[model samples]
Target chain A: MNTTQTPCRELQVLSCRPGTEPTLVDLVLSPPGWTCRAGQFVMIRPLDWGSELVWPRPFSVCDVSDAGLRIFFQVVGRGTRKLAGLQPGQKVAVWGPLGRWFRIDENRPNLILAGGVGIAPFVMLARREKTDNLSMLFGHRLDLCHYPYAEIADRIESEAMRQTTAADIAAFETVLSGRIKTLSGIGQVLACGPEPMLKVVRRYCLMHGTEGQISLENRMACGVGACLGCVGRTVTGEYVQSCVHGPVFDVRDIDLGE
Target chain B: MDQTVQLGPLTLKNPVITASGTFGYGLEFMRYGDLTALGAICLKGISLAPREGNPTPRIAETPCGMLNAIGLQNVGVKKFLAEKLPYIPPGTTLIANLYAQTPEDFGELAAIFAAQERVAALEVNISCPNVREGGVQFGQDPAMAARVTSAVKKRAGSKPVMVKLSPNVTDVTVIARAAVDAGADMLSLINTLSGMSVDIRTRRSRLANIVGGLSGPAVKPVALRMVHQVTRAVQVPVIGMGGITSAEDVLEFILVGAHAVQVGTFNFMRPDNAFRLVEEVRTLAESLGISSWDEYRGTLRA
Candidate 1:
C-alpha cells in the first residue's frame, strides 16, 4: 500500500502490546493504509485531543498486514505517553507511508541483523508467507525481549554470542563446522538496530564481499524534507534528511563510524 | 474568504504566519504555498552579525517530538536588507525577528529596520543568551527583558515593536509585564524548551550539542499556559504559538487570549498546513455565526 492512498484523518488501532513500562509500546494499526518497504516509517498524531502535540511523530513500521499497520515505539515524553495509553479500539490520526525502503534481491539469501526494537520492521518482512532462505543475527542486552520471529531459522549469536575477531570466528566455526555455508550467492544484506552492531555488520559484509543496506535512526521533525531537522551527512558530505533520503542507505554510501 | 488580519499598525491579509527559524526568509515555503495569503511572515532569528551557529547534531528526535539548537544561524541585518527585505509581499506583515548579544546590538538592528518601511514590526527575540553581558541575562530576568524592549523601541522610532519571550523563565507573566512597561506593542510567547536525547547503547547525547530546545506538540500545553498567563498580565496583544497545527488549536489560542497565533514546527511536517489552518478557522467561525475570528478571543473559563 503506497501511503498516498490513506487520508491523514483516518486510522484505527487494531492491537496493542506493552513494552518497557510507561515508556515503550507496540501497536498495530487497522485497515493497512499503505505498503512500506523494510526501512520506511509513518507519522501518527493523536486526534481530537487538544494537548500540545500537534505535529505527528515518525515511527518505524515494525510490521504491516492487510488488516492494519504495526509500530514499535518507546514512550519518552508527552506524545508517546498519549499514544501508549490509547485503548485498542480507539483511533489515532496518521500520515504517510513515507521514506525510501531498503532494497532486497530475491535471488540471494537474506541476512537480517537487528538490535532491540530495531528488529521490528525486519520481523514484519520475515513474517511474510512467501519469504524464504532468511537468517537473522540479532544482538540484544538480554534474551527476554528478543522479538518473536517464527521464520528466522538460524541465530548467529544469542546469550552465549560475544563480539569475535577473526580468530574467534575460526573457533566459533567449529560449532557449525561443515554445516556452515559460505555467504556466497547472497546478493544483498539487510541490517538495522544499533549503530555499533550496524558498524560491525558493514565491516563483516565488506570482508566477505557481501552487499548490504542499513536503516538509520535520527531526530526528525517533519517526516518529510521540510524541516531540515533530521538530517545526516552522507559520505558525499551533503546533508540529507534521514526521513526522506532514507532510514535505509547502501552501507557503502554512509559514514557510520570512523 | 478574504485573508487579512490587523496587527496593531500593520494589516495582514491572512492570519496564517510562519514562525521564526522554521521558514528561513519566508521564501522557502513560498514554493509550497501562496505567500500572499499569509497574515505575515517572521524571518529566522537575525543577530547583528552572521552566526555559524552550534556544531553538528543540532537536532534529535524524541518519542513524539524533536529538539534543536540551530543557535539562530543566519546572515546579519545588512545582508537581510540587501537580499531578503526586497521580496516582502504587499499587505503581508514582514516581521524581522531580531536577536542580539546586547541591548545595543538590538538597537542598531532596529534602527536599520526602521529605515525600511517595508518591514512591518521589530520582533525583539531576547531568547539568545547575551554573550557580552556576563551571563544568561536577557531572558531569565524581567529587568533585562524590559531593557531589551526599551532599547529596541527607542531605535524603532515610530514603528511598533513586539517582544518574543523565552520559555526558560520562571514566570512568563513577569517578563510580559516588563516588556509592556518598556514600550513593547505586542508579545510572542514561549520559544522552544531546552531538552536532550541520548542514544541508549552509545550513552552519548543524541544531538551533536549536549542539549537543545524542544519544540512541537510536546511543548504545546506549556506554551498555551504561558500565552494565557502573559496575555492576562500585559495590556498589549499576544501572538501565541507552539504545536499549533489545526484551526481548533487556533481557537484554543484565541480563547486563551492570543490575538493571533503562529504555526512553527508543523510547517516542517506539512508545507500547506498553515494555509489550510487559516481556511479552517475562517470556515469554523462562519459556521458558528461568528463574524470575525476575534470574537472568540480569550474566552477560556478561569
Candidate 2:
C-alpha cells in the first residue's frame, strides 16, 4: 500500500461537537490530499509538545468529504485529552491514510455491528456504498450516544445497554440471527468497536455461517508498522502487526481467546 | 562533506543507519520518506526459526521513552531470504540482524546470510532483552558473547559481522572486547536498557513479560556513555545508537568514535528521520567547516 506522511499542518477545524457523550469529540480536519477509505486510520500527534508524549496516537478514519476528514474519538487518555483541547486553527502532526481498509463486496448484503466510537468507520462505509442491502446494529449506553445514522443506514437496529453484559450480548446475538435469516443472499458481517463486542460479533458470524471482518483496536506506538506494538493473534498461532497486516482482519483468521 | 563510512568491507553512503527492531525490513518507511537516503537499514532481529514473540500488552509508554518485549518476533531465516530480500530497493545497503538461542544456531544463521548476495553485513544480535534466553544472557557474559561471536565469524565466510552489545551489563567494554577478540569486524552499542512499568489502577505489570527493553530518548545518556566507553576500548569501527533523535545526537556518537550512527525510537516519532539526518549532518558539517567525518571522528575534547 502506498502511504503518505502528511507533515504537521494547521487543520481548520470545521466544528468540534459533543456527539453522543461528553467525552466524545467529533473533529473535522481540512487538510489537503487527506483522502481515506473506511477502516483506514491516521496517526495524530500534538505539535510543539516536547518529549511529554513522544508517540503518536492512532484513530480510525471516521468520515471523509470534499471539506475534510472527520475523526470521532472519546477523550480517554492523555493523548486524546490533549487532542480534545486543540482549537480550530491549531496544527497537529497527521500521518496516514494507512493500513488495509474494509473490503466490501457489492453483491453480498452487508451487516455492520458497531459500538461507541466504533460507529465512526461504519458511517463512512454506509455513505460510500449507498446501498439498500445494508443493515446496521449499534450498541450504546445512552440514546444520545447513538450516532445520528438515520441518513446513511438503510435498516438500522439499536440496543441501549448501560453496559453491554452477557445477557445483552445474548439478546443481540438472537436479533442478529433473526436478521441473518431475513436477508435473501449470503451476507458479510463487518464489525468495529470494543473487543467484547467484537467477540460477540465473531461468535454470531460463526454460528450463522456468515463471513466476517473485524477492525481491531490495539494500543499502538507507531501507526506505520515500525514498532510492532499493536499486534493481534492469528489463528495460525502467529502474531501480526495490526498497523500493517490490518486494522481489519478476517474474523476466522483472528484468535480472540480469553 | 564526506559522508561515507567503512565498516569492515561494507561501505555505507552516510553515517545514518536505521537501528534493528525499530525499522521493519526497510520497505514500510519508503512511502513516508526516501529510504535510499539512509546509509543502511538494519532489519528486525531474525532467528533460525520463526518466533511468535510475547503475548499482548508487549509495549508500554514511559517518560520520554517506551518499553517493549517483542521477543524477537520475525519470519525466520528461510522466509526472510525468500520473501523479504527480493523486495529491498537496489543500492540500499541491507544488514541482517541475526539472533539465536545457541552458538550453533548463530553459526547456521551466519552461514545462511553469508550465502545471500544482497546482504552487506550480518549484525550478530547478542543483546535482545525481550527474549527469555540466549539474548541478553549471552550478551552480558563475556565468555558466552565471545563464543557467539566466534561461532558466527567462523561460518560468516567473507561477510562482516557486527556484534550488537547490550547495555544491561556491569561493564559493556568487557563484552565489546570479547566480541572484538573473537573476530567481530565492527560493533554497535547499545541495544536497550532492561526496564519495566506497572499499572497503578490495576496493580499489574505493564508488559506481559513483566520486564522489557527500554528505548527512546530516556536512555540516550546511558547509551552515549557506553558508546564512548566501548569505542575507546575496541579497535573495530563502532555503530552507536540509543535514543538518537537528531543530527546533533548522531554527531555526538561520531565524536565518541562511532563510524556510523543508528536512529531507533525516533523512527516511530518521525519515519523520515534517517533521511532528515543525512541533510542535517551535511549542514552541520558545512557550518563547522569540517569537510570530512574522519577529521572529527573520536575527536571529542574531554
Candidate 3:
C-alpha cells in the first residue's frame, strides 16, 4: 500500500461493537491500496475523543471487505470505552494494516484456540481461506451470543464455551488438550487471547510439538515500532517490539512463561 | 516563510527536527513522509555496546502526556553507522544523540560520530546516570555536566555539540551555562521530567521502572519556563521542546528564544505530524506577520 498517501482520515463506520462484552467495529474504508493480512493490526481513535485520551488504541484487523475495515475488541480501558461508544457515520482516525501477518499454510490442519477477543484476527484468517483443515475453539467468560461467534460458524468446525469458574476453565482445558491430541503432530496451532490463556495454549503446543503462531496484545503507544513501548520478550532473552516484529509471533520464537 | 535556520556549524532546511527516540532510525517512518523534508532527524541514543534496556510495560499514559523508561535501548554506535546509517537517505541531515557510562566512553562515542561526515551534529544527553559516580544523573550536577560536555567537545571535532539538558534538577540553567562554558555549541531543553504513576487495583507502579520520564503536552509550561531561563543564561543557540503539539507550540519555543524546536512525544500521536508541521509552522508564522526567523526569534515581550 502507498501508506504515505493513506494518512489517518475520518472513516465512517458502518457500526461499532454489536454487544457489550465483545465488539466488531466496521469502518467504511475499502482496502484497494491495502496489503492487509490476517494478523496485522491498526491504531485507531475516534475523532471526538478529547485530549484527555492521549493515545490511539491498537486492534487486530478483523476483516477489510467492501463493507469496511473490521476490528474485533472488548473495552478494556478509557480508549476502548470511548471506542465502544462510537456510532455509525462517526469519524475515526485509523492508521494501519500494520505489523506482521499470519502466513497460514492452507494445506495443514489449523486448530485455532482463542480466548475472549483474542479470536479477533482469526476471523479475517477464517474469511480469507476456507479449507477442511481449519477449525476454531473459543472460550470466553461472556456467552458466545455476546460475540460475533456465528460469523465464521459455517466456514469452519467451531466450538465455544462460557467459562467463568475454575471447574468451567478446567473442563475447557480438557477440551483444549483433546483438540491438540487430535491435531497430533500434523496440525499448526494458531492461538490468541489473554496471556494466561496463551500460556496454556503454548504449553499444549509444546507438549504435542505442534507448530503454530500466537498473536500478542501488549500495552502499545505507537504501532510503528518507534515508541518502543510494546516489546515482548523472546526465549533468546531479547526484547523485540511486538508492534513491528510480530504482534503475531511464532510459537517457538516467544517465551510466554507463567 | 524562509525554512532554513543555522545552529553553529550546521544549517537545517527547516526548524522542525523530530526528537531522538521518538522518530526511531528514520527508516520506520519511511511511509509516513519524506525524511529529507524535516529540518533534521535525531536518532535514538546510541551507546558503546548494545543495551538490552528495561523490562516490559516500559510506558504508561498520563493526563495529556505519557511516561516512558525505555532504558535507552539501542544498537551500539558501530552498528548504527555501519547498518542503520546507510539506509537513511543521503540528503537528510542526521544528528547522533550519544549516551555512555562514563566521561571517557562519552568521548569515544563522540569521536565515532565525529569521524563520520554524514553525521551533521552531536546531541549529548547528559541526563543519563553516571555509573562511575554511583548512578547520579550527569545533568543533575553542574560539574558533572561540564565534565561530560568537555569530553564530548574535545572529541566532537568541528561537529556542533548540542547538550540536551534534563528538567529533573533544582535549576536547569545552571547546567545549561556549565555546558556552554565547557564549549557546547548549542543546547536543547528540557528532556522528559522525572515522574511516576500507579495502578490502584494492582498496587503496582504504572511503569516497570517505577519512575519514568514524562513528555507530551503536560510539560510545555515547565519547558517554556526552562527554555526562557537557559536562553538568558547562555549565548549558544537554544533548541526548545516539551509537549509541543502544534505550530503554535513550535513558534512559542522560537518566541522564548529557541533557534529551533524539536517535536517529541507528539510524533507518537501521529506518524506524519512532524512532516505536516513544517508547512503548518510556515503558514502560522506568516499569519502572525512573522517574516524571518531571525527577526521573530527571541522577540517575546516581558
**Which model scores highest in TM-score?**
3
Question: For every candidate, how close is chain A to the native chain A in TM-score?
Answer: 0.78, 0.87, 0.91
lDDT of 3 at A128: 76
Docking class of 2: medium
Q: Clash totals for all models, in order? A: 13, 0, 1
Q: Scored by CA lDDT, what does every candidate get?
A: 0.71, 0.83, 0.84
Error of 1 at B247 (Å): 5.8
Residue-wise lDDT of candidate 2 within A27-122, one digit each (tens)?
Answer: 887754667789999887756656767788889988878878788888888878877777776666677778988888777777777777788887
Candidate 3 ranges beyond 4 A from true positions: A1-9, A17-35, B128-136
Against the hidden reference, what TM-scores do the models get?
0.64, 0.93, 0.96
lDDT (Cα, tens digit) per residue for candidate 1, span B136-198 = 368778888888889999999778898888788888888888889999999987777877888
Ranking of models by DockQ: 3, 2, 1
Docking class of 3: medium
Clashing pairs in 2: none
- Stronger candidate by lDDT (2 vs 3): 3
Candidate 1 on A135-230: residue-level lDDT in tens?
665544434343444334432222223333666444433422221235634456677876766776666666566677888886666665555566
lDDT winner = 3
